[model samples]
Target: MNNIEKIIEIKDLKMTYGDKEVLKGINLDIYKGNIIGYIGSNGAGKSTTIKILLGLVKGYSGSVSIFGKDIENENNDYKQKIGYVPEIAKVYESLTAKEYLTFVGQIYGLSYEKCDDKARKLMRVLGIDYAYDSRLSSFSKGMKQKVVIISALLHNPDILFLDEPLSGLDANSLLLIKEILYKLKQEGKTIFYSSHIMEVVEKLSDRIILLNEGEIVADGNFEEIKDSSFDGSLEEIFNQLTGFKKHNDLSSEFVSILKEV
Candidate 1:
């Protein structure tokens, strides 16, 4: 993977909202066809970086380039090759599943005929075969998630950004999605995956980039991450790097509190 070309690059990225600085001098590169697990706790600047990458948040001081083209010069034309599934399902609740997907496809400059065909096939595979005409407000969390996933994939983008994409999926859906992502990788698609599910990241990620306090804390594969001779899962490595201490005494402390009551 080291020999692979970088599809996205960020240099000296910094963003400040109001008085609070969110991203502080960040630098990173995303290679083509790499499944990068972007791990971070709440307020660790993960979302901020993604927003900047997708051209949502603006006025940040730094350089961001995609396909070696400066974003300032390229904007939407450059963004067309990217697909994003946000952490929240924020689609129009009044629209039916089919209608919502049509809207998304249109936003990506896809035709209604193309969207209908793609949406039906994707929904069938994602286990929403029967909900195409149903209102989005009547759908469950998992159902809505399926729709969001289909929307992002409707355009067959080169770069896919998934932020907690498996938020409301069931076991079957989770397995199916993992398989689908694996297939996408085989097809040479780059994926930026963000989630708190350490187990999933450990299993699927070709490389893990851990973010802490608006900076890159650790960036490498599992072996490279455990190069310090620590033998454990990504969760253990994460805890060690993030200054997490053993909570062996916390259980007893809580028990004592319960006893006091």
Candidate 2:
């Protein structure tokens, strides 16, 4: 693909934490307007890779470019075009939900009226309108997650980076968020989402990148990956590719101990 058409490009990226290597010579190219799912087991370097791309982690050995701007040299400009939602939702405890969103909009250089209008619309769509004026410290986990999502989208960024976007969400809210993702994709926004939910990833992703122990084990569309691998669903394919075995050793050991008790 042409360089100009690509939204994110990583080349020979490497990151190490003390004695442990988190990412090892990873390369990826993400085009514009595509919803890409990043799937991996815990400590597989998915978050590390994303942090590098977002300029949150530094001192890595590689080249990363977002929208043709080098991350190392032009992070500020690139950051303005991207929105990020972390795995854990964090908001100002004393501030109301509307106040938090207003602050975020101001950081993005949006007018108060525009921010209020957009925040109300997003809160309504995400089913958090009733709690918009409540202090975030009193909100439930799912409610806080909705506020984070709304804040991330307040600026209508061209690229969105979401880490575990569905965490602490109800089934209805999950569906609503899924619909929002689809709508964003339709509007030609690039989304890079990380999650362990294989079923949801299979349904929503245009492409999937599987990582294992800081290395890429598989990368392709769901159909292509399945066709090239053993017969099964995405979960099965993932288990097979990542060498995950569902042994009952722990369960068996616990049951044996219970017999003695």
Candidate 3:
């Protein structure tokens, strides 16, 4: 496909904090309607990449384009076409569920009636309909997460960037969120999600990108990585490709010593 057809394009992306480089010449492209999974260990710069795409951080030395516009130059128009759900769900504690989402929709330039209708539908799907009028401070972790998801979709953006979107969700909510993601993909919405959960990535992603120490280590489908002898399961392949050794081996030795006691 041509470059302009891609929903998200990153070329030679680089970022640094002091003398430590966080992103090292990263290059990636995500097309419309595809779910791309970004997997990496802690401090691997996954979140940094997402932030740069969302224009949350600037002064990077690469080019990033979303929906056919340069993120730097596009301004609000580009931002309005994308939705973001951060790893931590932050909401106004004093506002009710409906109230909070209404506020978010307004910021996206939606009318009050449209926002209310969309918010109500999303809340129902997220199993938070009963809490529509409840204050955010009175909601559970999962409830808060649902609110965040609802807010992200209220504007009906073409691209959704989710960072650890299922971090604090319960099992039911997790399944619900996954289903919702698949539905969105069916509707031709591009989704870029990051997480440490290998199984979920394997199941949900059309393609996976492995990052290690601010570098793209592996980028391909599961079968391709396995055929290259990376390993069988996604977890095994990730560890092998990223050169991550399990610290649990040390714990095993300690447990053996305790057994002798």
TM-scores, one per candidate: 0.94, 0.94, 0.94
In candidate 2, stretches whose alpha carbon ends up further than 4 angstroms from where it belongs are: 1-4, 254-260
Please give the CA lDDT of all the candidate structures: 0.89, 0.89, 0.87
In model 2, the clashing pairs are: none
lDDT score, residue 218, model 3? 86
User: Residue-wise lDDT of candidate 3 within 101-185, one digit each (tens)?
Assistant: 9999999999999999989887887777988988999988878888898899899999999988997799988998899899999
**Candidate 3 lDDT:** 0.87
State in Å the error of residue 53, model 2. Answer: 0.9
lDDT of 2: 0.89
Q: Give Cα distance to truth, residue 250, candidate 2, Å.
A: 3.6
Model 3's number of clashes is 0
- Which candidate model has the greater lDDT, 2 or 3? 2
